[model samples]
Target: MGDDVDRIKSRLDVVDIVGDYVKLTRSGRNYKGLCPFHEEKTPSFYVSQERQSWHCFGCGKGGDIFSFVMEKEGLSFPEALSLLARRAGIEIESYRRSDGSGKKTLFDIMEEACSLFRTCMNGDQGSVPRGYLDRRMIPPQVRSSFELGWSPPSWSFMVQYIKKKGISLKDAERCGLVLRGNRGPYDRFRGRVIFPIRDITGRLVAFGGRIVDGDGAKYLNSPETEIYSKRRTLYLIDKAKGAIRNGGHSIIVEGYMDALRLHMEGYPQTVATLGTALTEDQATILKRLADEVFICYDADQAGQTAAIRGMYVLQQAGLSVKVVALPEGKDPDDLLRSDGGKARFNDCLKEALPLVEHHIKLLSPAIKDDRTRKSAIHDLLEGLSNIDVTDVSPYLPSLAALLGIRDFEVLDALERVRSKRRKTDRSFDTEEIPSSLPDEGQQSQEMPPLPEIALISLLWSECDLRRKCDTREVVELLSDPRLKLMASSIMMGESPSSLEKRWLEMGETFQLRVLARGGAYLDEFTQNSDWKWRHFCHLLYRQKGQMRYNELRVKMLKGEATTREIREMEDLRQKLVSQKGS
Candidate 1:
């Protein structure tokens, strides 16, 4: 580990940082959330509030806050550290050693370059870039908002401009805007409308330019420099972050206009990859806001292929990938210009198909030949099997019918292929059970889905259930151990707040033990208005008044009776009834 790493880790708490990114619900002593760096339906991301660290069981991403930022933001070690250090309010002493030697960070240089570029765009002394903006139909307000600028057309423009400002050509070249040429130096983004790319903190670190004439590339971006990686950025994530969080989804488009158009048209959460295929780095950044993402790329062949690759990439990251199948030959920008664009886009979202369905569609067309047709069917089934179909699984039979499979045997065959493919592809870890108790019951009966656990946990933890029942007396008459545990857990946790923390830290293993003792179901109890566990407990306390003695008195004379002990039987019934009353 670097000294900086140790320093930041010592000062910043990972739990606090990770919690800012993902909403963590307390599970025991730890908090659980959907991993922001991976695609997962249920949360496997665990953050230890006690230890101030996080570990994602799904993707195996684990670390302190600095590590999390570095990995997820695609920032360098120093960059991540600088961010954390600033967050922790760490102050630095001015370095003025006689032999003076401290290096300026990439961020520092990028800052200078951004200012220079902005100056050039905003009528830097003489020449103005406003003419360029006017020609493009981009409103001046839009240009200024996005920090549109220009680099002088002359080769010596940047070299001369920055040299006068104490920035060397060597440093400028490293920032990806200057290159060595026979006639001294040249501006990399000469004669173009510059679109400065910035981080979430508004640090201008790179630039993307559009050529004014038939010039070179349509879009020329800064090469990978110390501070900027083209593949690691999206065009306007900083602006879209709040929108993404509010919408609970992010729509990734293909170009700058697509993003701007969407945002300008009220879909503020839309974003675009910076002239490259979606990178895990970018996906990780988006993961901070939403678990579900819609890829609304262009509908060309290249776009379709890009969609497929992005789907797999994000799926591996644990995000649910939905492909917004746009109309043929249209991009988000193209469609947004249509008369009914918004409605069309929404219809697309409503019709958005899962990755597996898209995969099936891709394979369906090629299944013309008999042998290849069989292969295609198996392939489609394999893809289908990966889907957690409990939610959408019912569609399988309807889809089978659509496929014209009327016979049960043909349907069974497809299902079999699906099962086989699932077994082959999944290779995911089987959770290990250390004891016989959990294993025995699991072996005997199919274990309930963990999604149900998530649903129950949400309900049990947050909902005010008093509105559900009629009265305290009726609730007290309810019998079910699981329901009672739910009642107790909620009521007990409500008292101290520390009890909630203690409950959070308990491991899943212990939780499973509690669940196994019939505490998994919530059918055991009921409640009504003004109903609280304490209130119910008060009811139970008073109601247990009579039934305790009759059964015990009979049990005393019941002998150490055999399995057929009538007294013991009566006692058990009375005991159960007493438990119910409570």
Candidate 2:
């Protein structure tokens, strides 16, 4: 695999690969071009041909050819490797065989399942499902392009199919295609219209089955498995990502059908959540793909609530959010299907309200009703407090008008709401300590000091520091479990970019936060010798000791401290004091 990578790198020049995506001109030994990752007027993106690296000064993104492909294409490392290998005309069939994780096997199983479903959809068994699609106005090309399929109404059909294919029933079960019953393994998607679900990298991972005519749930999705996580997967993202990048925004809907309809109706940048609220993980995924998101959910109360919750989550992830107001009780599908619906939908997109304004619009009726006025005002203030102040500030006058309150009063109310929420979050019971030690959950909840984040970032950025630092010692000093895992991985020779990719795959955004917060201290840590790094480690140890000391002191105050705990508390206090003195 190493030799394969070297061969590919040796064949593909970074300048040539990047120039295909970015327009670059020779600037001395390097090429400069507008960054494809972020919006920049000047050409801050520089490609160094000599070093085979590229960096964007605007976004602080810098990496080699593989990293560039991964970022630009929103692909996983394996996908990027396959893409670049193919481009470089280097065969890596051996590399795929070397994967011991069984991911490749799972992927192959999913592909087989998809093929089986598609065959069933086109076969005689698919008559009812095909009729249902016709009624829904879905064209044959769209259905075929989306790989729509059908599962025959038979308990043993898929079981027999898998057996004949020589595929393990266990592998099928792992892919969420088969389930073990009291009798034997049965098909999970019997008598249903199947929607093949692919990951962002265009790999089939799971399926969503919609009952055409049956005594089962209206919709059923593949269960969480080794390769498929509903929160991390978006419907049609494989098809929509390119359009999302070109359009500079994304349109989010609530269901698979809605996404399909939007895509078929010339909205190629649309993706659907897996019939759930927009999770922070999903928001993080979008945050990487686009700067803004427009959510077009059903117009019912439940859908509006979902839209509001999703807007807050997306905003928290730093993406500008807008709510597409569909007509009452109409989803994107229904709205698009109505007379003159396409133009109306386009108008809705044009007139989508920003997050705060949309929240205000939702509360308008409640505020107008005298009986619900106070509650609506309170709700509005609480919701506003969750949003960034700058985002909410511009709408204060409008909100005040709706509430029939003074602008300053509205601002004061918002501040009070924010203060109350902060106090509630910080309110911890110190008197209820049973032991001097904090529980694992409590320890995990304790936010690590900013300096610790900076230290981890520095270690990740500088390979020499990773080699110098003891893995166990660094892991012990880290307070956050996530950081501990990251430190261990770094010490085990995982590259920072690889770790970042892993975190992104798992839908974790803490790495991004760590890098952003730790950027300020990177230069400081680099300029100072190893002493600064050692000092940060000492500070972490002292911070841990101080927390323990505080816990023990609380227990002592409550008269619950044992002799052992008392001795340990004293030792911690002394160590912390000595460290402080040093």
TM-score for each candidate, following the candidate numbering: 0.56, 0.63
What lDDT score goes with residue 534 in model 1? 45
Q: Model 2: how large is the Cα RMSD against the reference?
A: 15.0
Which of the numbered candidates is closest to the native, going by highest TM-score?
2
Best by lDDT: 2
For 256-321, candidate 2 gives per-residue lDDT tens digits of 899999998999999998977788888876776668999888888655854576578789888989
User: Candidate 1: which stretches are off by over 4 Å?
Assistant: 1-104, 124-137, 181-184, 200-202, 338-340, 359-582
What do the candidate models score in CA lDDT, each in turn?
Answer: 0.62, 0.79
For model 2, what is the error of residue 204's alpha carbon versus the real structure, in angstroms, after optimal superposition? Answer: 1.7
Off by over 4 Å in 2: 1-101, 423-582
lDDT (tens digit, per residue) of candidate 1 on 1-582: 366566766876666567546766666567778778965555668888677788976567897776888787676665666666655666443223243222234555666766777777776531445775564346667867766677667777777777887766677788887888787778887777777777553445688877775568888888987767776677887677767767788888877767777876788888787877677877777776678898888887555753565566676566778888889988887787788988998899899987766765666664655667766666555545434323233355555654557433343454466555556666764433454544554432332234334222333444454334334443244343344444455544353244345666763243343343223222232443234344544444433433443344335333443555544544544454455444
